[model samples]
Target: MTIRIRTALLGAALAGTAATSAVAEEWRLNNFLPETRPETAQIEQFAEDVNAALADKDFKLTVYSGGSLGLKNTDLLRVLPRGAVEMSLMWSNYLGRDAPALSSVFVQGAISTVDELKAVLPVAQEIYEEEYTDWGVTTVGFVAIPTLSVSVFCRDEPIHTLEDLKGVKLRVWAREQVETFTKLGVAAQIIPQEETYVALKTGVVDCALYPALYASTISLQEVTKYASFLYPMASAPYTLGVATDKWESTDPEIRTAITTAADALWERTNQYDKDAEAEMAAREKLGEMGVTWGEDFPEADRAQFMEAVSETWQMLAEEAGGNAMDYRARVLEALGR
Candidate 1:
């Protein structure tokens, strides 16, 4: 009897172990940027926070940065719903093809500053959640980077005026950017961010519209000699999303923990944006790398550029239609425009 009782206890212990192992969940997060970028760092911090919060739960998050998983930025939304990826950090511009509404924040001349974008963030989140839900995903957080403004990084020459942009083969990402640049007589070329350095180095594109910080991140300063601070293009915001079914299956406590972590990430990102020393250090680093910074466009020139890009905004609003159109209206109203 003693021997039989001992064997039964051992069998029960093995079953419990197997059940616990089966219940454990591993989530994969895909980030397109290199580990050095602030965005990547923010996501990494988020993962750590989640892990710590859920220490008692059978949940673990693994982050794959620098596109190590071989998934492009554009592939994130498509794959996340299909279960190919559990989570992703994606840019709004990349989703413009299928969901133009999500990209409304990036409409040229529509949102001029980070503050204006923040003003509409609540509505933007709602809109994004609706769209993400439709596509079988759940949005957890938003990552916004603060910069002086989106600028033109040129290889051979500085684009100081509208005339200088004429006939320039500028690399563009979204359709709206293409329209905006085309109005200024620029030959816009849509290319992947990963391919930008080589394109700029090989003269495939004379200039590209990117954030000022990219000079250090992608070594754009090496290939591009001049950075032109142009019209105040809206910052391209990044979204954190998880597969809908996975999110639904998660325990309520675990979901709350993830939400709490996401809120902390938002606060951290906002503080990072407000840190002037960090911005200056990045700019100084770019200067040390031999990249010349052009003056901000003259007030009159800036006004003219804004006016020219207004048409692109109108086109995007019309193309977006439905919920996207409503979202843009909310954002514009919030901007007091």
Candidate 2:
């Protein structure tokens, strides 16, 4: 070929390369947990897996951990529907304002173990699908963080029975938790996670209803003397969601690649929670630091606790109205309650 023909072919090749680069898709995934947490690492791995799956396709995913993007966990669900962010690993219960049914999973006594959660997840996902569809978001998948039982950690007292919790000021996260504690005669204060450690230390709250792993994560063991496993209050169900329109418009193959990666991440994270090595080690460390763990509640007290929780569930369902009552019924059936 002549020099002119060769130059023309080189120009076309460069133009194609630029076009490919220009069409490359970049997605942002936000997580509120610090990078040190296992869940955050799992989110990063998900990004890596998706990028690897689409390596040739020029799709890139960037993960922002520890709320570095400045979006609070509660804000994720609201902003996602508006397309302000591409993706997020959000706490399902935090979406109670928009979708109260989603909070059913976090209801006290609703789900007690990982196996129970797995059983209820399908129905929960169905409920979530309808809710997200209405909100203009799509759920990628449900991830079960290790079944961290929300236990009570007190500075000077251990909550052994229903009587122990009465009249005590306890810090809580969700409205369901607040309602449950309030019915038990406990003064429940809604406090953000970031402020919990100080609240416990400074006597802002006498006790806190939070996960054992999280207590370990924030070093709550140092300030609190006793950890009560009286009630398996709630389990953390982390959800990954994306903008619905973005998902619908994406290439089907890329969506498949991302979803496949998400499924694997879910399994890995679930197994990590099941193994409970980290939680065990954390408890051990807390013990060394003089934190005492309370024995399980006596059978009678346990029964009474569940009865109250059941009542709270009914009240919540009634308050939510409409599909919420149906959703709560489905969750209870799945849990075999």
Candidate 3:
């Protein structure tokens, strides 16, 4: 079944209900990423830390990875508010349709450098907290995603410039990416990460825009022969959110434990230098796997791409309506753009 159909059915079945039992504080943390991913490992550690902190209490945090809870990432905004799930690691880009303002707070290509990302995060988090609270979810803390290098992974030919991308069917992740690439006269579509490898191998798409740090996770190196540097994708952090009602009703000590654990997770992952080092390591691993790397995209073309993506940010904010533009302005102000 399509993700939308599956999400709708699952949402309906669990709507207006608390999925977690009230007898104990055993919370289910839903992670949409695969169990093999490092983020899942970090989340698992966070749960362990929280449990340790609350050792004397009857509180436990169980992490369900790889969508094992039968919950879709896109359905999180709807289900989280109703307490259908007690906790989730939510990425705002996946939630654009339901929480446009939240998505508009930051876009991957909007900030190119790690310093820019660091400068803009506080403002972004403020906006995220506001939006999540309005949606009935309490933000505990955020886990910083590594600032990975984005690349154009193509099958037969290299794509390093705007001209080369014009006729190529490119796979992107978010609507903002689709709009930006489309503005640059490229045909870009949103394909899920799981399907991207097959899309390139079977000629469903000519190329894909993905992070070099994560290409090996889905074995993109096997399908795409040529890869070229695009930009450093500094995406917004993953939010560790709990159903607000559940949070409020919990014991004060347990709440403190959860908060402490979440804060430590954020600190552990927020190192800019570590992010760069990891990306470099991942890129090297991709090369050892028999993938051929192309030349860096030209500075002129990078500038043009960023300009187009900036326009897309504004378009998304206006489309989202209701304080989205204001949020964007605040983000820009933080970046001094």
Q: Which number leads on TM-score?
A: 3
How would you encode candidate 1's per-residue C-alpha lDDT over 1-337 as one tens digit per residue? Answer: 6999999999999999999887868888888888878778888899999999989888898899888889877666788888888888877778877777776655655666667767766766777778888888898887776644667888988887777777588887777778877777778888877789999999999998877765577778889988767765546467889898988987898888888988888887764355446555766787788888887667887787787677777677788886767767777787788
Q: lDDT of each model, Cα atoms only? A: 0.78, 0.78, 0.87
Steric overlap count per candidate: 0, 0, 0
Question: Could you tell me the lDDT of residue 5 within candidate 1?
Answer: 100
TM-score for each of the candidates: 0.87, 0.85, 0.89
Off by over 4 Å in 1: 1-24, 272-279
- Candidate 2 clashes between residue pairs 3 or more apart in a chain or in different chains: none
**lDDT at residue 83 of model 2 (Cα atoms):** 80
Instruction: Write model 2 residue lDDT over 3-98, tens digit each, in one string.
Output: 999999999999999998788678888888777777777788889999999988867889988778888767766788788778888776777787
- In the predicted model 3, the residue pairs found to clash are none
Give the local distance difference test score of model 1.
0.78
Superposed Cα RMSD, model 2:
4.8
Q: What are the candidates' C-alpha RMSDs?
A: 4.1, 4.8, 9.7
Deviation from native of the Cα of residue 100 in model 3, angstroms = 1.4
